[model samples]
Target: MSFPEDPIACMRSLQAEFGDLAVLEEKGQRIAFVFSPELNRRVLTDPTNFHSRFFAVRGGRRSAQRRVTSGLLSVNGSEHRDARRIMMDVFAKKVLPQYHETIVGMTSDLMADWQTGQLHDLNEEMVTFMVRMTGALLFGITDGEYSEELGTRIDHWVRQNHRVGMGALVAAEEYTSQYEQLLQMADELEVSIQDMFRRHRQAGNSAQRPDVLSLMFRAQGTERELSDEKLVGHATLTFAAAHLTTAHTLSWTLFLLAQHPDVAARLQQELDSCTAAGVPDFAELQNCTYLDWVIKESMRVLPASSYSQRVAVAPVTLGPLNLPAGTPVIFSQFMTHHRGDTFADYARFLPQRWENAKPSAYEYLPFGAGSRMCIGASLAMVELRTILAVMLRKWHFQIESGATVDGRVIATMLGPTSSVPSRLIAADQIANTVPVHGSIHDLVELPSEARTAVVRRAA
Candidate 1:
């Protein structure tokens, strides 16, 4: 079957028609699609056979674009093992405390710009805020200029990659012409990453600096020291991985909370009761269970990184289909999380579902699973929790009734395609769900009428 302009709609259709596995031809290539958790396990567990290669066109063997994008997600076998081993220390539990301080500080910086009753495109606000936050966490924020410049470069490069690479799904020649533009941005991005590395090295504070770049640099003397080239790829991918997805999650979570007010009220109460001074400490966050449920449910329903593809390294059979080596296989977080059999009333935004729900990694993977799972998962959770708590505790948001909200799937991330216009209200004010319209309907199931769903807790 052929896909449409909206691939999410197509995937839903495929799920209904083909329960577990489906294969379709696009531009003379057979692409396999897997839906079930078992199938997801089979594909993700054996990365050796199903290698992760995201870009349809990787310029050349030594292209800057190819190298910069070759971090953990794109690498395989020994290289992945080696990289993951060294990077693990950088993302370890201990480092997250320092990272937490950065997240809180940057979020506070963004919040300082707000005025009540003012309207903002939440998507734009979140995206811009994340650029600064991701940069500070990746490179030192103390300098600000380097972080802003590098963050801007990586952010631009990612938008280019998504704009061109998504079209590659159809093998459209229209996208081929822009591949050079994508590579050109990569070249610029690589230079910025290298320059940051040199400055960080020259400063001789790798040990003291807690940003990810400095931490990676500090690990330089070990046998597992990553080369300058690998660090470039790591920093680039890490920023790309951390930036937009978290921003979109923040946007979607806020919108969803506004749309489901009772959930919002209960969540607000939890945040109000647990957090002090509108900012939550790590210890306070661990006890904010409902807030956790809200974040998990938000991700489950409108996951930012919706679907990803992997290429087979050898001939393999997925379900009833036999695939040759080098074939691209697909797995979807959106589809898996929406399964009726797996999650009852799965389409609705039910944070309560997570209260008693237990699904395997493959069944509900927002950050993916297996060995290639996102390295920043912990940091992402902390950032989301801290920011959402700080922002929500400080202000209640009301989505404008006539505002049009839309979502688009570019590359693997699903983000707002239009401005999510909303007004910031006093934190003590209550938020209400209003009727809205857009392609956002294509992504999540929303209430037909004004929703007043309340979630009461048991003593």
Candidate 2:
């Protein structure tokens, strides 16, 4: 059968037709698709049975210039464990507290550029903000110039990657061109990472900052002395994964809040109660329970990493079906998150659902679970909560009437197809407006004065 036009719909159709473990032949290759949480857990947790090399190649081959540029996502066995352990030191709980001040400061600096009445594509804006933040955290690059440059390049690469899937049969010129461009960007990025490494080395241990780069440098000559290739690979993966996923999550959360004013108002109230003049410290940010629920619900609705892929390393039984070695296995966060059995009123945006019910890791694998779980999950959460808290406190947003906000799968993550067009009204201006609760449809009908304010400021 020809590949379905809508990938999401295709997955649903397959599940409906063939049950949870559906096998399909595409382009002369046999692949297994899994939807239930149990199978997803088995595929993700049992790396020995299902290897991640397939997903790693999703970005294309490792650069030949680097002998060992394969990052943790691409590697398996002892190497994966060692690299993950070394990297975890930088993202450890203890180090998270140190990043709080930096993250808040970054959010403030980004917000400073926002003009009250001007229309903005929150999706694009969030991507820019996250690129800068990740750059600082990963490489100690305070100036956003390099980060912005990298972000633009990465966007191009991601778009191209999505467009040109396996590229085994279709050899279109556009695909070839995009693939070349992607490789060139990857090369440029590697050079930039090497420059950062060199600069960090020259500065020496005494002058080193507490960023991820510094931590990696400290590991040199030790058992964890990652090869230059591995270092570059880690840096590239972190830059792409860290910013893209978190930015998408933030954008979705903001959009959901705009659609659900009652939720936004309640979230803001919680923020106001815990924060001083709208700024929350790390402890206070953690205490904003409703804000956490909003984020969780947003992710549940539109996950950043939509789906994950693995290839069977050896003949294995997945549920009732037997799969041969080299068979590709697929599991989707989008499907699992929307499962009716796991989430009631799955389509509705209800943060309250999480207040009492807690799903196990198998049920909610937004960042994946077990040994191969995302190492940056902690840092990503902290960044999301802190950024959202700061932004929600400062502005009330309204989605542009008639504008479409839909998910477009780009590479591994799902983000807006285009700009999530919306207008930002300064919180002080809306503080006096009557609070509207319920569906975003209701919230879009702003008072005449508020509408006038938006137009007036635009003028």
Winner by lDDT = 1
Candidate 2 runs further than 4 Å off: 1-5, 54-69, 158-165, 168-185, 202-208, 428-459
Relative to the true structure, how large is the alpha-carbon lDDT of every model?
0.82, 0.73
The collision pairs in model 2 are: 259-440
Q: What TM-score, computed on C-alpha atoms, does each candidate reach?
A: 0.93, 0.87
**Winning model by TM-score:** 1
The parts of candidate 1 lying over 4 Å away from their true place are: 1-4, 142-148, 162-169, 202-204, 450-459
- TM-score of structure candidate 1: 0.93
Candidate 2: tens digits of C-alpha lDDT, residues 345-457: 77677889997868889889899888889899889889999988888788877777645445666566777666777787876433233222222222123444334434544
User: What's the residue-level lDDT of 197 in candidate 2?
Assistant: 75
Which 10-residue window in model 2 sums to the lowest lDDT?
435-444
Encode model 1's per-residue lDDT on 123-223: one tens digit a residue.
99888778778877887766656566777787777777766765665676776578889989888878877887777678786777778888887776684
Positional deviation of residue 397's Cα in model 1 after best superposition, in angstroms: 0.5
